[model samples]
Target: MGDRVYLNVLASRFRAQLSYRTSFVLDFVAQMLGQGGELVAILVLFGRTEELGGFAAHEVLIMYGIAGVAFGIADLVIGQLDDLPRLIRTGQLDVMLLRPLSPLAQIATGDIQLRRVGRVATGLAVLVTVLSTSDIAWSFPKLLLAFTAPLVGAVIFGSVWVVACSVCFWIVDGRELANTVTYGSNMFTSYPITVYPSWLRRLLAFVIPGAFVAYYPALALLDRPDPLGAPAFLGWCAPLAALAAAGVAGLVWRFAIRHYQGTGS
Candidate 1:
């Protein structure tokens, strides 16, 4: 029953996005351009220098593809609704909450954006290109892990989005900071984390676990050494780390809702 309701909501969103054909096409083009520019910048940087922090040009490209696909899919689906706070402020959340199904699920399925499909295709193209050029081994287990790596990355990025949105309940102005986390982290994660300073690397690794989400896992997939000597367990723990982050965000979201002091709309 719950799954059926979610499907209905998703169908409605798909139809609505289809209603704005021109806008959706333009949005898709803009996103592809922006993403393409990001990759071009990385390529130009690598052209000047063979490698950054022990990762070769193509290796770094793979990392970019990993982060891009992961984040693009996430934001296109569950993460883009970071606007929940504004909805709650204007009493918009009341309608969602009053629905028979879960409000959170409703919000998640409310917008089935097809523009993101273009980004996903571009991301996968880059991913396949890099993989084809790289010298990574292709054992069944390694192949399985490599394919699933993006899933963990997507969850991690989405969790960050959720946490950022939840902060809006306490401080409406904090949404900008949340954007910094979502967009900044997305950009930062696309490269080798080792390029960053020591303190920054440690912060992202332990504090936010962003380092593990892509960097560490990519290192493992590429059969490279752990520059920071991150624990062997860290690579396997990527999905768990994402789950932990989402769990914390969910707890905070619940608290915010319980104590929701509306903007009195």
Candidate 2:
């Protein structure tokens, strides 16, 4: 029943989005231009430099592709988290809590950002291009990793988005600041992790687990080593890292929900 409700909500969102055809197309184009500009910048950078840190251009492109696909899928599913502040500020969250369905599920499936499809398509294009052109030898594990990696990444990113929105339970109006976590982390993950300073790297790895969502997994997939001296096995730990982050975020989200004081609307 819960699953059926979620699907119905998702379908309604799709139909509603379709109602705004011009706006939808403009949104799609705007997102494409934004993402395309980033890709162009990365390519231009590689064209000038032999490599960024120790990673070659194509390798970094794979990293970009990984981050893009992961974040794109996550943004598509959970983009409502970014608007959580508005919901809280407008007191619409009361309506959500009153529903028989789960509040988190309601928020996630309540609205779909179809513009994110542009970004996902761009990432898949990058992935296909890199996979075809790059000469990395593939193994069975690697092949399996290719399929499952993005889904794991989406989960990890979605976990981060949830935690960011959970803060809205307390600071309803000012929660837009949480975009630093979502967009900031997404920007950071789009490049080779080795290029960043050691302290920054450790912060991203240990504090936010951003490394797991992209860098560590990409390293393992590409069979690359960390110059700042992380273990080779850290790459294989991506799934565990995601689970740890998601677990913590889930706990925080639940606690926040329990502590929620309505906007008194």
Candidate 3:
């Protein structure tokens, strides 16, 4: 697959989406409002107590910001892959298979949810708000981290999306389970991971590894020692975690393709 072809295809889709400006605006606003519900829940929780799970409101907001941007960008770029089951059921998978270009690249460009820019915008707002109000001293390294963390997070979350969608090859309606994992992790990561029960914590850290996506990276950013028993340097492991997630997702995706017997003509 030529990079230029992928870029052109993505660009064309983006232009097409722009043609429906009203629909685009409504979709964007709806997405933003959906994300707002999470912010409200956090506010209500903090209304009753000064802190939840040993994190101040601002600290939690920072973590939330990181999680938001990471999740948003990942979803923006690769979330279309989640539509695999639907395409397969509708026999559109055969069209993609007949294409000369990479089917994954085609999917990447085909169903770009421009509405997700709302989530990314909200996330940037959160990050800026927290940065202005929070007491954490900003250093050059810290600034670099703040900039790069979201990209690292995008890789991690996008990789998970890939693996989740890969399962569609085996299960016809795999979306619900995948959403449970992805959305559940998004909701769960908006606060300190330490707040969850031991089993849940272990699951996020070891199985899905959502904990490392935002929590550990935030810990490193804020210079906070682990409230949990783990060593401090683990905070710096987000990029490596992302790489691992991508590696696993790539293996799963390839395995799935090999097994994929496309829907009949």
Best by lDDT: 3
Tens digit per residue, CA lDDT, model 3, 1-265: 4888888877888898889999999999988878777888998999999998998988898888888988889889988887888899998987887878767777877879889989888887898899788887888888888888888888888888888888788898999888877777778878898899999999887788788877888888888988887888888888889889999988998788778888865
Best by TM-score: 3
Per-residue lDDT of 1-265 in model 1, one digit per residue for the tens?
Answer: 9998788778787888889999989988887877777799998998899988878898888888888888888878776467776676678787776678766777777756778877666677898888878998878866876787778888888877877777787787677888888888888888888899989877776677787667877777788877767666666778788889889878877887788766666
TM-score (all chains, Cα) for each model:
0.92, 0.94, 0.96
- Decide which is better by TM-score, 1 or 3: 3
- Model 3 alpha-carbon drift over 4 Å, by segment: none
Alpha carbon lDDT of residue 166, candidate 2?
A: 86
Task: Give the per-residue lDDT of model 2 (tens digit) for 189-265.
Answer: 88877888989887876788888877777787788777778899988787887898889988999899898888887
Task: Flag regions of model 2 displaced more than 4 Å.
Answer: 19-23
Compared to the true structure, candidate 1 yields what TM-score?
Answer: 0.92
- Descending-lDDT candidate ranking: 3, 2, 1
